[model samples]
Target: MTALTTPREASDRGGPVADIGPLPARRGRRQHRLAPLIFISAAVVLFILFFLWPGALGLLYSFTDYRGVGDLNFIGTENYRELVGDDDFYRALGRTFLYTALAVPAHYVVSLAVAVLLTSKTAKGKSIARVVFFLPWLLSPIVTGVVWRWLFGENFGFVNHVITQLGGSSVAWQTDGTLGLLVVVIAGTWASTAFNMLLFIAAIRNIPRSYLEAAEIDGASPAQRFFKIQLPLLAPTSFLVILLTTIGAMKEFAMIQALNGGGPGTENMLMVQYIYRTGFERADIGYASAVSMVLMLILVVVALIQMRFDRKSALS
Candidate 1:
């Protein structure tokens, strides 16, 4: 057996006293503290590099007449002043808002409906149904656009072929601005519904079964149980879903680009598309940056307003 000595005895021997309890505990505590920081450092570095750095550069460029190549001349808000008076900018912004307004509610309703269906106790083949529902979301936006374009292509396309076979004329899905916008809205909703459905499913599952059982025992119909208990309880998740959907809709680009290229003469051009055209096509980087900054501000304002409304709803 190894020799054991008291602290006093060890110190008297001119040897360091054993720290049986505190040393290991302190080291463990330090490891615990450091692990979180080490884990988060990579994310922090990425956020700084990708988001903050680019955002700073964009903001700086917004105040300067920096064409993609030439010397930067500080225009001191001239880009912003011109943006304020630009008809195209306003139209794009309005279209973006319209898209968001249409998309968010559709996403909510369809996703919620799917979630409710999948979570029903009597539902069968849920796994297969979930996979099928989620497949659209797994597709690349470009692929989704291509698939939708094929389906709704104006002529020599599947839908038109079916229509012509059935004695109806081919619809102007690609060429008509309103019809094209409607197609995009439908495609966006289909692509996005799965993720929001998952969120609602998780939220619904977390709710106590007892409450639902009690509501059922009290002779509540399916709709009554949902509206009286489930819907009220879902407010937080609903808010989150709506907020995320709104932000995503506002920033949408790839799907729209692939689907219609903001076509029919910029009739459906969104704010991001407008920015892209200004910066890349027109070589007006300064104006594009200004528009980006304004769009960012608008998103911030919208988010804040939504948060305020959510808070008030919760409090009341």
Candidate 2:
């Protein structure tokens, strides 16, 4: 027996068939993938417009006689040529490096020691000590410099008063070239120690207790355990702290301004202060821009070197 569909029924089933191929579906899929990018595109545009565009313009203006206003003229490396012979700028540059070299190590060592003490079982009032130590870090660098300036005051300061009470002559801490720079370093070290201490503290606590217990069971002395175990583990954290502290030290300006205003005839002048005084006070905008570009290059080179060193150290 055979059952057959009629022609009307076959036409009814096939009447609405139409082909829409993979191209249209692929177009729909592409839009689905691009939807998230729409939300993030505004931030990307803003960064390029504000940061990248301004930076590029600054680099261009460095080579021209753009006096922060008025007509601009193409000077063709004249600003850079003048910078090569600027003795004051060179001196400020040297002082900045010297301060960084001194302050970074001093801060690192002292902060590590304090962090060890605070995290030790024998230490008392750990929370209170941490709070007191970190309070100075919370203060603005300008405020720290101002307060230290008062403390370094010749006669009326508490430090001078104490010296007088002890029958010692009052000392001028900021007039001598060497002493002035040393005071600046001391103030910077004090201001930054707490933050580094906190970093070291957290790093030390993260070390596995099992390693220490194992070392002790093997009859290792505390010093032996620390040097052989803890120091090796902390190398990464040490690298990070050094890198950050070095950069911060290099850009020091607020403290220098509030402390001595780059006084004593540029004894305490730093790179940033030099740039500021040149661009604003002297109205040498072109030269200032050139100097700033040089600084940016120096920082970039140093940072690259540091990163390479850190990577090798960590691998070893």
Best by lDDT: 1
Give per-residue CA lDDT, model 2, range 75-159, as digits (tens): 9999989889999989999998998999989989989989989988889999999998999999998999899888886756678
Alpha carbon lDDT of residue 237, candidate 1? 99
In model 2, which regions exceed 4 Å deviation? 1-51
How far off is residue 246 in model 1, in Å?
A: 0.3
The local lDDT score (0 to 100) that residue 73 gets in candidate 1 is 93
Q: Each model's TM-score?
A: 0.93, 0.85
Q: Each candidate: what lDDT? A: 0.94, 0.87
Q: Where does candidate 1 stray beyond 4 Å?
A: 1-22
State the weakest 10-residue window (summed lDDT) of model 2: 15-24
Supply the TM-score for candidate 2: 0.85
